[model samples]
Target chain A: MSQKKSSEPTPLYFVGIDGGGTKCRAELYDTTGNLLGAGVAGAANIARNGDVARQSILDSVKAAIEHANLPPETLASTLACGGFAGANLPSASNALKQWQHPFHSFYFTSDLHTALYGAHDGANGAVLVIGTGSCAAALKDGELTQFGGHGFLLGDKGSGAWLGKQAVVHTLEAIDAIQPKGQLAEAVCDHYQAHSATALVDKLNQANPGVFGELCPIILELAHHAEPTAQALVKEGCEYLSAIARKAIQQSNGALVLAGGVAHALQPLLDSDVQAKLTSSTHGPEWGAIMLYQHGAFNQGANA
Target chain B: MSQKKSSEPTPLYFVGIDGGGTKCRAELYDTTGNLLGAGVAGAANIARNGDVARQSILDSVKAAIEHANLPPETLASTLACGGFAGANLPSASNALKQWQHPFHSFYFTSDLHTALYGAHDGANGAVLVIGTGSCAAALKDGELTQFGGHGFLLGDKGSGAWLGKQAVVHTLEAIDAIQPKGQLAEAVCDHYQAHSATALVDKLNQANPGVFGELCPIILELAHHAEPTAQALVKEGCEYLSAIARKAIQQSNGALVLAGGVAHALQPLLDSDVQAKLTSSTHGPEWGAIMLYQHGAFNQGANA
Candidate 1:
């Protein structure tokens, strides 16, 4: 018996969502993969904001669909993929999967998953993210390996948060007379208007990742000006990043792609060998989210 | 005033409270310096436990008062001094001061303050508390200066929690194939039954300072057994501790006294120079609390 071709919706269009601790971004594309529109919303880290994460994601996706001037029903027809913070955790991923989205097909993965995918274009390679939080991931064949990203408590070494935290620590030490005040320490004190150890500590106790991250550039600027303490912190941070990158490169035997706002500032401090092996990434994690469906990395489940 | 010597309280007895994160200990003594009794209760870190800290402290002190077999009215006659965790924080100390305790007088200070006083026996010196958390404090001419002990996030450098944290970090690295597993890592995995990197990360995220502190002795035992990784961690811990101790000693220009359960265990790991400068503590923080009255550190206010 010959099966006749039936009229079916084309699976040529896709939506990508990159969810972060600070904000979420969603983008839509057409059959030719031309840029359609993008939308931004608040934080979508499920571990941090819980149920709010779901709403942040929905808002971004809906805004993206509207901005593209597409029919609202198109959101239900298009394939959607997302990579979000804390998605690696079973509790987080399971909760996210239970969300009843209008998309024809939905896929979810960890932010690191799309990061490595976007950085290396689904090839065996390594991607280092050094934003407010840091993580190093390597994709070898299909298996993914991670070195850090243990959150602020256990790890996130060489991250913007780490740098800022170190700066604050040094400032406290200086205020306590344990260490001499340097340019970075002075700037930190000036930033918080903390002239004593007690005041500095009080300020630090109330600080979150965002507040700490704001000090990263100031510390890096001191490094650029050749301040000894700042140079030491930058050197130490780069060393940690280099070590993780080296391990990922060794594991994957592939290219290295660095991401995040702090990455460029830190790259100059990396060892010559690490710098030599670095490669540029053409797309962001949002693009990688869409690529996940296109490359079959994101499962279609019963929708297929 | 000399004519009104009839029917007055002697103000001869003293109560000393040494408050910690995991427990609050109280000791009672007479004017002759004879130990009357001691009692222990739950955590008393006001910054972490809030109202619970006050309850724990009261329970411990009440138990000690009872154990001392003193008259109920003695509590009102006794001079009391408390060295509590987070006492340096104005909010915590201020709240504590508002409590109406049955004491002739009350004094408040950070745990480090009492630790230093106890270790030095009221003399100007330096003390290093290397327990679940680590801190170094120097006392010179009635001035107390502290270094480290900014808690797990910012500092607490050469502490049980820090060592345990390092072991877990190395375990994660080994699990990820970033580093080879060592004896310490093996023990950590065995303890948590974590056979994979993901499991290790999950276990680490759920662990608190107390949980991490439980692992310190295991890591230190491995160090004593000459395990390379454990030795490395111990070496690093000693270096950090030594730096702080050195600065405190230099600042105070006095003898060094080591306190806390982890202190004696870690003494063997200290550099010969730091070890040479160490001196035996004549009294505990309870004694220091008593001495606060003798030294007139506690201000006498209306019973309110």
Candidate 2:
């Protein structure tokens, strides 16, 4: 129950965002819960680049507004809540909080958090995100417990980035003649036109996780074709995912939601136990974010 | 054999630099080959940071001139040769070459090249470099062949960065309850004051290789104390080094030189065959750089 101006209580609107490493998605809805518009924008992993993330958020929201046929000023009366990858870092979160936003108010949390909320319909459950990066979380009662979502530098074992980087690693080994490279190495080499270790190093010295993650399709394809190196990489990923999925299930005693860009591709590859615990989401993270905004707004008003 | 003005053939001073991931080292010598002065500066991995590398080259050279009790303007008259890490990357190399250097001439090459030149006194031999990064090279019959040493992200196995990163990876696994935290993990925890998984990720979200590499001392100490995790990391590194060292030995048929900041500490741990090929470096990379410069200068003049 938000305090309203008695003179003229205009209906409010909401926008929910799922800001990820690869892209930012936004959903705009009116007070009556009608989805008016959806928009997508660029990478918004706040931990990596606050400037880019801030711009991405605004861009996505603006695009949603345009698609919804709303006036530009509508943003001033809209409530916004979003989950962003890399906002788990306090510094990144603080940086985003300090953004000069156009919305009436903005609420934010980790990308994984909102995904969990959506997966369980704002109830208690668990989720394992497998995409450019990987991580897992379980909600028990009201508390959220997370496991194995350490960023890229710390191994996100099942992540697309991890698999892609592994391809590079073994390619280097192959180029060094330390091991006989498999089909996967050759595929990666061909992708980058990197016939030698020095050449490969030249191309990727300053590459981000996304660049490495671009090799995932090849890895997944070769793995499907029974390429030993590719299959081995996927297997290693499955092992990590299986461990975390089992833990999430045990800790929360709830169904686990598998999500993210690479989720479906990896879904069938998951262990039987993990598969058994898996469930489909009732709504996407954007919808979940709108729910979060409503709940947060209500609490603030009540506390006041 | 360098061309000279008829008015006066200037007796040029020389400064040789070994620009590495951790530090930039310079050795100044007169034409007579007498060591005049030496200086040290900050990390100069050209691929990671060209501006820093460029500044480091100038800074170290200036410091050496000061140590030689030479005037500040001596930099203009000094012939400089240096090997810098990350210079193998074409972009980094081009960037360095583009710098408006104050030297009489600045000649650049990979840090490994200078190390190999120093190791065998500019003769045909192989050198395995194991410091904050690792790589091996063999030089014979005017052709230099390189092995391993892609870089930190691609896995420079057994390098300080590699060992330290493994500690973090294992520590994260331990905190995630995926595996038991070993002594090395605990040591890493104490160093970063990161008791939980989130705290560690927050602290290291933007950390460079040097930050992780700082944990190398702890890892090395733990390995020395027989901590299984630490020992395993060291063993993994040694395995890589052994493989590359064998290749270098077979290709060059020359003595192998173990060098780098971590070289001495890891020397005894190497396989016996690798040890058998080991020979003392006749000079450091700086001295080797001087040899390279003199030779290059000669050839340049001869061609002219």
Off by over 4 Å in 1: A1-15, A28-36, A48-80, A91-107, A120-123, A271-278, A294-296, A299-304, B1-15, B28-36, B62-80, B94-107, B271-277, B293-296, B299-304
Give the TM-score, chain B only, in order for the candidates.
0.86, 0.93
Model 2 TM-score (B-chain only)? 0.93
Q: Write the per-residue lDDT of candidate 1 for residues A1-304, one digit (tens) a residue.
A: 1001225465556778888766788988886789788988977776555587788888888888899998787776777788887777665666766676667667878888888898788899998888877778899987888877766666677888888888887777676566787778889989888777666766677466667888888888888889999889888878878888888888899888998778888888777777887999968888998787677776322123
DockQ, prediction 1: 0.33
The residue-by-residue lDDT of candidate 2 on A37-153, one tens digit each, is 988998889998889888898889989999999888988787777889987777777677667677766778888888888889878889999988898899787567788878877
Record all residue pairs in model 1 with backbone atoms less than 3 Å apart, i.e. clashing.
none
Q: Give the worst 10-residue stretch by lDDT in candidate 1 chain B.
A: B1-10
lDDT of 1 by residue, B207-295 (tens): 66667887888988888899999889899889888988888898889989998769989998787777888999888887887676568
Q: Which docking band does candidate 1 fall into? A: acceptable
